[model samples]
Target chain A: MPATSGHAARPEASGPTGEPFLEVDRASVQYGSTKVLSELSLGVMRGEFVALLGSSGCGKTTLLRTIAGFMMPTSGSIRVGGRDVTRQPPDRRGMALVFQSYALWPHMTVARNIGYGLKLRGKPRQEIAARVAEMQALLGLEGLGERKPAELSGGQRQRVALGRALAISPDILLLDEPLSNLDARIRLTVRHEISALQKRLGITAIHVTHDREEAMVMADRIVILNAGRIAQIGTPQEVYNRPSSSFVAAFMGAENVVPLLVEAGGERLRIAAGPVNRAAAIPAEGRRLGGRVVEARFRSEAAELHSATAFPKEKATEDALVLDGVVMQASYPGGVWRHVVKIGEATIVVDSSHAFASGEAVSVKVPAEALFLFDATDCKEGEEELR
Target chain B: MSVLAETAAPARAAAWYWIPRAVLFGLLAFIIFGPLVNLLLWTVTEKWYFPHALPLEYGFSYWGRVFSPRGNAMGSLGTSALVACLTVFLSLLLAIPAGYALARLRLPFRSLILLALLVPNAFPNLPIYVNIARLFYQIGLNGTILGVVLVHTTHGLVYAVWIATAAFGAIEPELEEAARSSGASAFRAFRDVMLPLAAPGLMASAIFVFLESLDEFTGTFFVGAPDVTTLPLLLYTSAAGGNYQIASITALILLVPSIAFMFVVERFLRADVLANIGR
Candidate 1:
């Protein structure tokens, strides 16, 4: 395992040994006939930070709530420290959840809000006060302890919520998009603050979010959930660089997908490019591509666009793919110019440093390493039908 | 030209604003304050003949008489307070849980249940109280303070449930879930987080229940009369007997609780606090 300074050691590389700190085995949750989570399993080490990344209604929040014991799974079991806690309620599960809305007690002052859990546990008044003060200082809410939640700014209220969650000293910390409510500028700073705090405490944390950058920066392992199922789970760099499926590839900022026919030879895979595709031969690399059609995906920034008149006739590399297209639209989105290129019946957006006219013919060059290929039969439900 | 028009806008707007403002103020005073002034004057007046623009004479003798034991006003006042307080307690006990379920749970036939809660207030008071009085007689609860309180609570429950449902519905369930995740039990979460955050709405509903119970007359008359006399019943009997002074004094006594309740809950009635919960 690599020991990084402000981040946890990579959980995937650590490998499985003894029982994990938290184990969710084949958990499935259903709400009246609609299944929210289906046969999901995950294991988190003692001090690892894992992120569940997905779009809305993908069951990331459902999984978080189930792990926190707020929602009971219809089947399967959850174990914490080798003890089955499937039937236990949230209060007895030894975990704290920070809500996206902050969920601060609007009627109580900051000190009282942070001290509520201690008070419920019957801690001595002086001890509660001391712990509350410590949390306030840790979250940089020193002099504002007497102010109510309504008196604080959005960022300050978020800190108070974090302070309240941390003051309890739970075994696991659950955060459900806690920074989503903050403005973009505040979100960046708070993101670092929470990451630094989680590292400092070394508490096992599971953060659920839809923000790809947030997950990449804060989590030791990222679990991409699609339609209540795990699409892929790996280290941030691994998932970003090597997505396991077409859905995972599309989810990881590789939205442009092109279909191609592949014929597997002795050592190389011959790609039969279409009318707008460039023929290329690449090493099989152990990928199972038995299906005739393959879906090739790449990020918009990965493809370099140049005018067709200056394009070279021969291939630059054995793995590189070049495709012919015409610019359908072009616009500048801040730093770079983005062009929508029409190739055959499909359109893909590519980013360029220089501006190109809408009617100009161009060739898009995609490096081999930057491209991801998956069996077209494995395309997610409703996706291939649309194409 | 646009800049000049913008600069001159305030002067023209001010000239016409005062006219509408004065008319609104006058209408409000006439609609709300006129009856209150008349009621106050009738309470203090010793003698005021018909066609008199103002009372011919005024004194505190009626106020003194109402407080004396012979007047039986104080006893009725105590009865009204007891019934109203009990009604508030019982109504809240029933409404809070019902409201929570209605707002947060997926109960079957939810709209039907909500519509059923509104049935009590839809009908005339005479028919409802008569039926309740008959039911109380069969149960041997007629002419009892508990019976009167139960009757008042039935009326109060309808509005209480409606108001409480909206109140609890306005609160995000995430707030309570957060508490539960923080090592607090369900009851603790309700007590520490939900109750406080929903305090303003809950108090407003409770005040409405208290006031409704205090002002209820027909139910008290049918179910509690001849043995248990409440303030509203006393005021009705006094007015029916042509004792206008006593009726006025009884009305004033009933108004005191409503005023005190408003004062007690004024601080918690802040819109900012309620609107900003768990923001």
Candidate 2:
């Protein structure tokens, strides 16, 4: 394999691979009087693929552009390859960006688009031709080099954009939602192709995307951003399974969050779960009193529903927490059945193996570990409380 | 669907609205074209006045008299074309960059510059003509073709900048940003991405400025009286001199280019770009 062929060479250079290839320390960006990003710090290791995942206006794209040197941070610094490059221009910083719009020069052919950066850097004609040819072959664009961007398909235009960024062989590659313009199916295909290509090239990449699944699948680490601030940073599973905050938990597909009152009892904190579910145990460093239950939401797949008469068995796993309710609605979701069961005044959604009719009595067995608990006092459910 | 079918009666009635529209169009066409035909007839006739719609006599002697060896018909045509070309070139060179900067750049006090350009267009033309003639005389550009070209450029600059600025403003900044991120520099971005997209608008502004330079009478008459005789200036002078045939011939010369300019401009006017200027 080509991977093994390259891996056989002795590691070159003295710089430590452990040291961060790019560091954004306490970066704050402002557009006139409005502050877009505030005191955000992030680190990327050599050959690491990090995604700044957030919705629009969350400063994810702003952070990516700042790191590319298109935007100057009002405070703090950016160091790439151990060199302070905060005030450098985009072209001088040796970083290439693949814009969300696939900002290909419509007037130029695929080969010209791919070799534009090299031309700007003053590469000779033959060398540029060879490098462009290499990029075209690598991107599966061998015969389409003569076509303009307007002549190519959406996926092909994106590949040309990627090829252009990669042709420069910059220290880092920045992608600003490059897959956003593609159709959903094409987005998935191109995203996977981009991930494979980035890994093959062994280049550090910072991708900004609002698509949670895209971030989880493509990034080695996902940094969830909320309103211009870093809310959480972890591996895909780590962030999904053990989100430190309710925001991160919800962002990582834990769409269900219920308010809980914590009462400290030795090492295990008893969570007086909410109206819809029974109490559960969670480990916490208790420092506050119990608060009112405000909200409870959980993933539809995480909860289980069964006939109410079938009481909890003595050996229900510690991961399963139970609640009593009646099936308000049920649906067959291919593999498993989904039931929206109502318990008292609250409706708890759950998934079950067997189908149940509406108005049938049921119990929603929510795993204790799967339940995300947040104190009502700190739960505004808006950005103000999250910060 | 039933409601639409019931309303279809009024819609069918509305199709007859074109009857009045056709009549109005005919009236407007006759009002604009009638005097032009009468002027042509009078140019060839010996005696014609308000009551006579057509002439009894006609001859090519009017053209012979107007373009006689002693006449300055060719000289004035040469001057008019030269000044018009100069004005178009100078206005484009000055207006294109200023328009692009105003439209594309987020520069400080851009609205103030726009207001300054608009101020010249707001004032009456005679005051500007008098002031410009005095200024030119003071600067030793009194009766030269260069002086007239300068005055036409001044007048043309306002409308040129206003129209071209609007055209440049209508373009999507995303187009330029897309080019730059794909590795084109600021200059290349403008040349490749912006210029092609804005070609129709540039041509429209060019045609308007060319027509204005060809037909400016007051500025030339005040500053370029005897020495500079542009088409409009000579046409006005011959009319004031009581030689209606010469004046009609010169008017035809002036009218042809103006109509041709409008036709050319109409060919290049892209509804997509021009419609966005107001927005």
Candidate 3:
């Protein structure tokens, strides 16, 4: 897929009579005195996989549980396919959740576990058996039906959980960090399995995960949550390339941030060179550069390093923000060498193919499009930026 | 040379290891089977003096007499079985939901409530039995089978609640949530998921309650004397009246339910159910 910039994927015009499949409007959940979700609103289109991505305690799980009808919003309504199900119980919501722990019934055999929902719906024994067989084959779990969950491997158990959820053929599927418990090797395989199954079934799925790459690779749109509110909601490429806030920028792997001075020029913003940086200008369009002092953030991989003495004869590119720094420490991390470069008082990590010795001076070139600029005062306390 | 040494060393080590194990087995056998052997001999003895090392004669007369219609043994055994079954039923009925609540719900002073469930077992039985006797008398339930069953159920309910609480607590709440999300109603989820997962523990608790109620003596004696005669009370009264052979036979009879319960517990009441539930 070609990368889109700075815009959420537009809801399909023909999506089920022009309405979003699932709508969470102004929903807030309060636990005793503490509010976990504050007036959160989101719209998911039919067949769209929207990921609620956040660190722990960000209320992403709370929002997903609310949509699944496991939790009731203190106020506001949740409408699924044009029906308000805010006060409905989880069983009546016609949704299935693949739990993080793969919560298979330990006492039940694999077939029985997958058929539990069908049995609850009062389907005939034979029909339940048939559907269970079909699900077993679908998840590549043939000949393993009689085995209990404790007898199965982690990946097999995860597939059984998926099969169980899909057995009911619910309108929407909810995933709660379903891959978090698997080993790294198995997690990648199962992650693709879940994504492929969701796409093949065309089921509208809402996946909740703290892993950024998992959400980026799996979801059509990603909702980045911070402090019980959405920091930004956009496609993975848009959120990664053009984050709306410093928090989103930092969370999207832009951990190297440095303060810079800027002045609005005709059709461009002139960046003032500090004691450690060289002056440059970038187009002002689509940038919220109201203040003079702004935080310039870029990913470690986005910055290219050149030796201090080996100056190129060509002038500096208009789009590249060049900064001079002395390498304080260097380490080889696999294919690339990572260095801790000290620029004025701020230290940043820059990755380069070539290793630079410690205390060696170097020039770092960060392209204009790769540099995310946010207001200087927007920096939160205790935020870890230099990684 | 190393292989020879390894083989020789383990043989010597095995010889030394049997010493403590042998002593432990000898003590366990003596502690457990000693009284049982004496009881078995007593049931068949015709007569024996107190200082005699062995019975002077052996006969089947006491066994015959106990099985006879005049002995009232069968009636008392029947009463004991009925009371135990009733106690098991009532205790389980009350404990399943109570245990679920204690394990999963946000009750005020939950630990204190659980501690209170254990209060009956901790105190001396005499005061509790006296209080129960008084309460039963006022309610016109004294000297009746229902009253004895009620008192015995209270005796068994403590263990039922404790075992069921641990069993239900071992279950991951996420399993029930998974069921509910997969279109199982709360009741269906309990029946299909939680109940089956917790069946072994529940069965263990039920058998425990049954055994406890069957062996209950103080409350049954105090509340059920002269009318509702269960096996333990029968054994106690028979022995007090100096019918030693009949008392031994009755004691043997009492062992039936306990032995049967132990068999069931060993066969099904796995100790590792909690540890292995979500693994």
Candidate 4:
């Protein structure tokens, strides 16, 4: 594998008045023989919610723990508010971690759990009391001060865990799959609550999660990781629309994998799918030339499936984007019916308004811009690994 | 209709295993309790020889003599209680840290330490007593209550650590990590998360240590004689001196704590904890 370690410098401060609340500079972490992260670097602007999104073992959680000072990086340095905290212990770093399991002290009542960090820092009795009360009110844990963690429901336990982390008024809140343990319905509600809380407090948060949609909905920018390396870092919309690699494209929910060839010109690029995709125009230029179109992937929502019997009366060259296939199967998926159309040896799954019966001739209509093309070898490798 | 279905059902009686097990338990209970009852009968009776299956005579005369103001039995009871209490206390304090580390810490040499603990069990009992007695001569631990406690604790620490460590290890590590991340320091995390969770294990270990200290014969006989007369030592002395009635009474006395310890072990100590933890 080519080493793409050095790409861009630590992002420059946004004009004047911009200081990154947490900065991770070329941080690498290893546990025994496993290298969890390698020379990873990131910076979170003050109050910005950034989600480290990755499949498991992609070092997302390791990065979050390193920033929280739980796991010391083998190399590189971390700074919060321009102060180097590479050697500081977690409690001394002024950052709080909300664990995947909530980690609420089972022995402690909600109020005491919330006040524990303050007590550890040796705050005065009255001040600790005041802060605890304040946190209880803010978290809407008014009558729950006396309840032990075991007595609380999952959602309540989650709130208590958050309250405990927030009670200390941390500079940066570190959340490690904080909503992953909750049921799906409660997860959505808690995600909104956490996002609202982060915004209200104006606290920088670095959330690590495996769920891509959760990251998209909650984070201002999502950092996608692959293996022990970062694959892409962009705003959710930017990453969803224009993934740098096929890995990110699939991770962003573009499920349709098709093979295509890229023919590049001065200002425009044309892509031709191997009997699977219609030749479509993509906005690619200097960097995309000279590669055999081995594979392409499109979102299911991006392709339109039609019966091949309705193939246009025009010539194949004139309808360069049209392909013939037989509808193998179809299912009603919510808003529209979805069909799996088999084109000779290749199969493209597409969504359609009208249902096409099995064995019927069909053609998948893929808009030019919705298609994502990648190098054939890399595409095959990514697809195989995902499987 | 099918050979396979016909062959699947075995011809043997399903209840065949129960009868022998019930008979075995009955025999076991008799064997365990019969001696104690014989001793109880002998202590109350004046004399018994080969001719009579039952005691020849019964009276309160032996009990009166044993509990009389001039008797040495009460003094032996005092000595045994003091020594057992001290041994349990000291052994518990030592076992807590060792057990906690063995249970929770993933330290590199944990297995080595555990092997070292088992080393004492491999030593010959007589040589152990002689070596300990020689060491006692130098440190003035000779025949002293503290010396007896020290020896018992050393002998008992293995069982204590093994049992308590299993208990501590059975507690979920997540609870401790939760406490720590919730802002408790390492020490406080153990106190808050681990202590309550392992309470039954600690109690079980404590009861075993207490009973072992109380019933100790070889160590106390070598190191605690002439001065510290624990109940077990006193019973041994009476038995050796041909004082059958006093020996039987003392034996009965010794059985009480052991039985109590057995009850505690049965009720609270699930051997499953040890099985899972040791593996």
> Model 4 Cα RMSD, Å?
5.1
TM-score of chain B of each: 0.86, 0.86, 0.90, 0.88
Residue A360, model 3: Cα distance from true site in angstroms: 1.6
Docking class of 1: medium
| Clash pairs for candidate 4 | A258-A296, A259-A295, A260-A293, A261-A293, A278-A321, A294-A376, A308-A361, A308-A362
Clashing pairs in 1: none
The per-model DockQ list reads 0.66, 0.34, 0.77, 0.38
Which of the two, 1 or 4, has more lDDT? 1
Docking quality band of candidate 3, CAPRI definitions? medium
Off by over 4 Å in 2: A1-17, A265-267, A272-275, A282-297, A312-319, A375-387, B1-19, B39-52, B55-70, B182-185
For B59-131, candidate 4 gives per-residue lDDT tens digits of 7787777778888888888898898889989988988998888877777888788778777677888899989
**What fraction of the correct interface contacts does each predicted structure contain?**
0.84, 0.23, 0.98, 0.37
Residues A289-381, candidate 1: write the lDDT tens digits: 657678889999999998986656555336877888999999998889999999777899999999899999998988888888888865453
Q: Which candidate's TM-score is highest?
A: 3
Clashes of each: 0, 7, 0, 8
Please give each candidate's TM-score: 0.87, 0.86, 0.90, 0.87
Model 2 scores a C-alpha lDDT of 0.77
Q: By DockQ thresholds, what CAPRI class is model 4?
A: acceptable
When summed lDDT is taken over every stretch of 10 residues in candidate 1 chain A, the lowest stretch is A1-10
Better of 1 and 3 by DockQ: 3
lDDT of 1 by residue, B20-121 (tens): 999999999999989888889999999998899998999989999999988889999898889999999999999999877787788898778888877788
